[model samples]
Target: MRRSLQWVMYVAIKSIVVSCLLLFISGLVQAQQQDQSVTTFKELTIKSDWLGYPTPETVKSHPGARTVITNKELTESGARTVEDALRNVPGVRVFDESGTGILPNIGIRGLSPLRSEQALILVDGIPVTLAPYGQTGLSLFPLTMNAIESIDVARGGVAVHYGPNNVGGVINFVTKRIPAKKTMTIRETLSLSPSTERMLADSYIRVGGFVNDKLGLQLQGNFINGDSIRAHSDTQVTNIMADVNWYPANNIDIKGSLQYYKTKNNLPGALTPESYKQDRHQSTRPLDRFTGDTLRGSLIYNQYFDNGAEFSWTNFAHRSNRQFFFGDALNADDTSTLERSSPREFLVYGSEPRLSFYINKGIKQKISIGARYMREEVDYIVDARDLLTNEFSVARDWRFGNHAFAAYISDTFFLFDDKLKITPGVRREQVYLDFRNNQTGSKESNPTKDWLPGVDIGYQITDAIFLFGNFHESLRPVQFTQITFGGAQAAERADNFEVGLRLTPLQNIGVNLAAFRIDFDNKLEFVSQDVGFRNLGKSRHQGIETEFTWQPKQIDGLDLRTGYTYIDTEQRSGQFKGNELPLAAHHQLNFWANYSRADWNWNLNGLYQSKSFSDGANTLIENEEGSIGRIPSFWVWNAQITRNFRWDKRKIKAGLAINNMFNHNYFFRGVDFSRGRMPAPGRTLLFTAQLDF
Candidate 1:
């Protein structure tokens, strides 16, 4: 009987395999019949696609938007991260944060990217920000540029199709989907920047391939180490990610991913000018630091019905535990005081479940709807002594659970062979915080709700030219960090408008110009606790941007991506005016130009963000500036040249990177010390070599 059952199971498995093989082969044949033509356009010289949210409804009569950079772009541009790669996307502003040590903060129009999750970040449709908060900084989630297949920056209502967070638009880090052929990568970076203690080394290895037409996978891992360019600071980071995709039928596909990450740093407790001079680097001071581990997994399935109906489901979960060591240098050897640190380790974890559906085709109209449910819990305790010896105090111990729910609906209408398209969308979200973890509360936690709507319009003058505009509203509910005495503001909102023109004058060149305004209500500002519980509000912002790409006919192997942004941010209702937004620049200029021929490649890239206020308050109180607390202007230059070689089936490449090519000095302000200023990293150098088979 067991043998018979095994035989039956084997037969069923084989039959399923045979069916999938048939479907895959059929898709291949069909794909071939479609005359798979290879175009030289790597998104750089291509016109706008309806998939992006770049326009406003009434202005454009319809909505069309999307910007892309191909794998060839990554290779040719020689960018190292999402920020480094997307310098030319319309309305994007990248700014340096004093000591984050990851990458610059990214913003759209006038919205501060670091302040809220309103500006969403996605990796192949998966979120990168575990939580949006000051402590939950962007640096927490690290992504190597090498893993990117393309990057799509959608502004205005384009964010609506992505669900409710579409308020500030969306930055989708579309990962590289392995091609029909195999691919491999190896990268390494070195630094000689001045540090408090140690040097820096950042390296990564990624391999991707398809076992067949229907199955593919990508495995990647990396390590990062850098010393404080200022003082008393050192950083070490490492992470690994794995992704797999499978197609079982012509219309159905499944993808899954797993990630593990860890980071350790010599955290500077806080630097006052006196301490700053005493120790140029924070790592030279105390050893109070933070170390943490995070593990995450996600599974997604996509199905396309013959009738043009579509459905998708994404399940994701993240588990992380982190500990903060309070300053205890006063009496370390003493066992009694050794455990008397001011802060203790806490634990938290959460999960997100999402489902979406859509219908498009002959329908003249397309509709989409989706939902997400998030729940998280945190545990905290006080340490007077050992758990066995320490007496637990109800007043000091804390624990809690929080839940957030969201749902959204969006649709698009097409006219004139889709030459004119309009997309309208809306989303409703509710959040509940349960002090369920703490037994000491007369009231555990409060609940909140927010509603956000967005719109996009696009007009295709011709197949290769389109003009668009967008209106997107963003909402960010108060996160756990704002739960100081439960008096935190309910939620914040921003209404941003963007109008732009995108044209592919020729098959080999593209240009985009845009003007935007982001008016925000109750936007978070930096203020002293002595002033008020909340930051200053009533801010208005406006900006203009232009992006360009060119691949000259002479150098068919050359690709150039560049752009500029001029931002005007003001606290129209507060004390600050004429000052640029905090943590964002008023003028950002960046570019990438690469020339490749034969076995040699030359790439030059430069990034610049004009000085702006480092403090959200835009004031210098008890500050060195005496009035305006600002981050002075800065620029960084990088150049790379590579030589390619091949032996049999093996391909090899060697390159060099000159970071901050010139040993320039600059201060990174926004401080809590006698002097509120930090220095930028000095000139650094690196080399790398990669082999592929």
Candidate 2:
């Protein structure tokens, strides 16, 4: 603990010194350019200011594959969960373990989808993953769909700006900001299932206004209560957030935000094939439950100089507590029912500073430099007891801490009369972790460092066509759990190569195609029932993703969009060599169409996935219990209709949606060693109403 404190202090002092130096340089630059009028830093009104929520045009200029889902797409899809919204993003895998969509198992490319630990998850550029270097479960997503303005997924070549676990990519959730004028909005939604009656009910309210010419305030609240498709499964989630934006000077802007979230979920354990056939809605273990709460705060500062240079800094902190009580069905022997309770507390604090400036040569060049420092601490305890007596006995108690520092610089040079762009970047990252087991009086520590470099090149072929390519290197550090139990584990490294094209044949039509390959070394594979990990040596993932969108002028308001992905993943050098990775489908497709005329809007969407193996061994034959085998391909469809009206200058909107239109039955995730499978929800209906004043 003393060492950790000292390290924290050292980083703090270094950050202060660097910040002062940057400020001094910025002041000098401003003074030299005082003759020119400085542009005032506007309040946070556009979503693009947030790190990940880049606009479509911005995405076209990005170095590698990127997907951005905006509010318009969210509204048209009527998606109740993040997984639903991400379906259109190719190369992303969503394992629907929780029928209510509260606990998401998300993966990008061919990475493991276990708890979404391999990917970096952020909210408005602030890390939200619980215990990033220890557990890293995205169980507590504080904001609801109503509060989100955009979702961005960057597949690779992002390590230069985002650090640490940028192995798979970066997923950033951007929340709505204060509007320019006073506004109040209320929204309500109800979901139902033929098998379980009422499935979910949600309520959300938001108010935003300008307190003064230089100040803005916003407040939001969301409450969601739902019953899962499985029997005895219930969930409740609540979130409250507030934001204040102040412009103390014409060239300076400051924003502060705070958010609180609490959630409880009743976990219905998986069931065998016979039980599923008898009744899919029946729960095998009804007492399993999970609860969590999180509090987060952030302060942001931005300064603009007359020479069009910008400096920004953000400081953020998060604290979270989570508890899980679940049936140990996999280890149960039928003689005695066993249960386990795991409780964890996580604390994280971080700061990031960035400076960007433009150089006007023959062609303009943009250069950005950034530095980040983060410290995280986690305390975990596990207890075991009999199901009947409920007398718990301590099994394990562990404490873990991680300290990380990273610095990066990126330069984008424009050539060929601003038609060709070349970007080169490099990032240096260092991570240190310490772990102690209180019950056993044992301690361990590990330190890892890496230098990542990348280059992106883009050429405009024509007025409506563009071609781009990128190559980057990224790394994922071994988590504390793996190092503590599995002994020493090597950090995973990945080299990604990608080439893509964006073409706009017409004003209303867009097409994108990308082909990429990733070489992974020292890959870690979960073993021992996911309690530990084993070095898989080497692996490779190669895939192609294509997307098309069209808005026909003939059908004034008609919109159509579709995307497809083909992935080939192999374990190159391991015991499972020549085998396909588990749970990664070979083919996936998504399609959506929406039409709007006047006050009425209608939309339909569908998703399809090919077969996938359930175990690393690539098990093909289905067992008697249907637990270990290849999952068959399946198709699911959804539709929605909305109507808008105005009464006395107050706007009102109503919508109805149907999910799983055919009631298809399929499993996206599976447990190994004859464990039961995770089932997806059946046909469901949802109704929504919104009022704006």
Candidate 3:
């Protein structure tokens, strides 16, 4: 009862504070009222299918929590990779596994970050995972930081449009678009690790132009070569892409893209407790390595009708191959003479068509209908090699196939002079999957279907305050391994809830606060050797996320952004009941501050995460394997300084960045292949230069 009273008091105080802030800012209400006009539903609904929220106003009006990390912010922060740029997001957590950012392990709201399987990752609205429905794990991430223009993350109210693995939400990496004017750019970045005595370089080139009034073309390339902090950790990456846009008529638009990406990296396998104490930077597994490549293509078509209606069709296809080599021992300390290798290849194709129209007879409404079809094929092989004989033999060979279909319908209603908006939608999914064990001469098929329903509401309480809420039912389809094992038959389901407030009390300041809860069911977990995989009972995850931004009028050319997240998770059943989930930190905070003066800019930023358990058992003691223990808290800071100059009518920029300025020592445990401690990179310095002609 005492705790309940305190919670009530807290809620009352927050409400009072918000009320006072709104009243204080009401003096500008007249100006706001004069400038405010209702945006037509058609105008707001018709935009690029890839964009989560196209404009700042749309973001504010959105019925759920959303964030956009812009290119300017990414550059000013001196971000070395996409992972570096995403660190500041309120509810997202990114753990470095490959050190080169070639592989991403992203989690949201206390979900497991392993392989980022719970989250739906997209590149310009197209799925980037090996297989969207059959195998959601992103063994090969094809995005390069130099080619990204922005990142869009949506936490809720998105299930009606996206699916299969969206319980954690949707993260879209938007690539750079073709410039309207002819331009060519060249950029290079170099970084040095003092502890490992290794140097890395990143090169980028972009050429774009408009050939005529109706046609535009662009080409981009990025190359990376480097060594991580640990021994025997060499990395190389290549990305090449071409984009085209054509406006054949006033009402028709066509866009297409082709991309190729490849990466090869050596893994410094994890270390045991004793080995870690002796030398954390030493690598015992010199032969462990990973290599991946992808070739992808996409096309989009849009047609606008005179009656305030729009139609769009999108198609995409990709081929990907990934391979990993590791020793045949559970512990890196073991002097194993045998090695294991797993190679997987995937072929995926998808198509989607959508239609949106306006109906303004009784009330302003925007209605949208869409359908999607996706097909996937996977070939998997496992091989074992003996060091004594230098011979290799196949251990397992499997083939997997999936056919998925989905349809959705949604209508958004505007009421109370556009101050109140409500949207209701539903989506249906049908999937058929089959797994063939070539070595065993056996095959199994699993067919499943589900319906997802969601609703979103947004109300403008005042000129400076907005309230939004959403409830969505989402699911994660049965993956490749789950099908291969033949124990889990149904998809994992979850009910997601979110409520938030977007406040702009002052013209120069903005704030966002949101509370979210996820009730997950039918979770899949590895059981005993006899059972293989099973559908675990239930789990609950709840959290609070808040962010603040200020561009104070008093301090010219200075900007500040900060955010905090609090998460609480519980395993509701099974042996781990009442225990916190692995890698789910209770508290996280991040901040970025930038100052500009006289052609020079300086930035300081940092991230802090509280201690978390490495295993579901919540073990407090350090285990011998270094995989079942409590992870200590850490603080990592970065700083950058840059200057702009003019060279014979050409523009030039140069900068220096220091990562891990404090020389913090941190490690991530229980990653793929090696369930032991993996040391993070130490202090590093980067130098960058760019030229535009």
Candidate 4:
């Protein structure tokens, strides 16, 4: 362990030295480029506030398929979990395994949803995965819903701007920014499950004000304590965030943010079919637990020139420690117990700098160039003990380090009287990874490089109609565990293609339609026998998605929205060839309606998912434990009502929400091999109140 630690430190130091040199050179270039002459052409407005809610117009203007869930929608829908907020988004699949929403398994366009490893998750444009190259799981999202201002989901053709792990897409959580004026907000919520007699409470507070004309500051705190549907499954989460924004010059701005998060959750292992039938709320593994602590800090600087040019840079660092304990209890009848503790520590730091400018000579063009460098280190330890004899059984320690460097450039050219646009971009990335085991004195190193390219084409049919198409390639390197346990697994790669159209034919109506296809090669799959991951054969996913929104002009305070998605997934080669991908639902639909008048708002939403297989073999044989089988179709409904009022010069809002309004009995996820079912919670209710001062 000592020797491995020393080697990690050495590599870290060398990486830092190289990063400093590169930063210095980039700074010099930026300084010299600042004096360039300005052009009259307008630059393609890069979405700087990926942290802010985008309007419908903004979504329509994007070059690729995208969705934005706003705070208003969150509030009106009474969404307590990220999955709830995203339920209306087409092509998104969320498996609420924990029921409390602490650990969410999410997938996009038929991709693997386990631990959300296939997608990229970010907070304020900074990656937040526990370990991007080592663990690659979004075990903990730093911020809660109350502290989040919006969520931006960009799908298809995102690799040029964001590096690896864009195979599915990018989900960015944007937190509330410092207020320009003095403000304070407080909110509290309580949820109850009548059947299980479980209760959950959430609280949030935010205070912000301007210190001076050039400076502003904000502070936010969030707390959540909840009891899950299963017995003994309790969780607690706490978050603290601080922000400072300064405008030193008329065209220059700087922002800094710090965040802290801590969480602990008790796991309720899956139950057998007979056990579930007897008592779905009973826990099989009551001693299992998960805990994590994370701290992150970031600084951003932006400079805007009079000549339609902009430069921005961000530097960020994060440290997190997490531990998980799992108890082996397949059924209520088991007597023997196996306890395992896996603890990991992650350290990550990175910088991103981008430049944008416009040219109007002949054909108008908007261009952007950016560079990124990041380094991560992880220390992992695992220990096992037998409960019967109280004896130690197994112990292991591993250390890994990863260094990544990338550069990308893109240009959007306008042709045919600014009605047609083409964006071509490419990213060059190189990754260096090293792993070592102290006990075995084993060391392995792998350095990989790739050049990914993408393009987006858009044609404006009219002021309110647009057509767009995009193609991009994505790659995900083999995770540390796969490398260490599976002996150097190959990277996962994919090609994504999408075409979409946005239309606003009527004043109160908007519609979006899209078709997408993803070809995956060397996909990663876990093998139980080897207890490791391997490169599976090729697979294909093709889908069509549509969304429509209508606000009746004749009926005041009434709005309607609906979305539908159809996916066809197939394993092209291997033993499971020609079989539908496991857990990939074939069809999904979402509908929502809202009415507001006289300070009263009423909302209703529904979700439907088609049946899917639970395993790669498309197994139909029902196991006694319900661990492997075909998942039947299911539907869920939720409703909410809110009232706004003022008392003694204070603004107050109150609301009530009922989930699974129809009392639907269904499961959102399944265990492929065991057929073990994780039952979904029944009817649940929640009440919320907010005060503004």
**Residue 367 shift from truth in candidate 4, angstroms:** 1.2
Best by lDDT: 3
- Who is ahead in TM-score, 1 or 3? 3
Q: Give the TM-score of candidate 3.
A: 0.92
lDDT of 4 by residue, 1-693 (tens): 545744654454444444434443443454355543322222122343321245556776677788998878889999988778888989888877677877777788888786787888888787888777656777665668888887888876687788688887888887887665567999998989888889989899998755445555678999999897678679899988877666678678777777789999887757777778888888776567789888777777888888888888888777788877876665447563778888888877778898888899989998888898887888889988888789985488888888889999999899999889898999898888888997898988766688989998889989889999999888888777777764557777889999999999988898999999999998877776556767767899999999999999888999899999999999997778999998799999999999999999999999999998888999887687677788889899999999999999999999999999887777744422113788877788989999988
Question: For model 3, what is the error of residue 467's alpha carbon versus the real structure, in angstroms, after optimal superposition?
Answer: 0.6
Candidate 1 TM-score, C-alpha based: 0.78
Rank all candidate structures by their lDDT, best first, as comma-separated numbers: 3, 4, 2, 1
Estimate the TM-score of every prediction: 0.78, 0.91, 0.92, 0.91
* TM-score, cand. 2 vs. native: 0.91
**Model 2 alpha-carbon drift over 4 Å, by segment:** 2-53, 328-337, 361-363, 526-534, 624-627, 670-674
Root-mean-square deviation per candidate = 8.5, 6.1, 12.8, 6.4
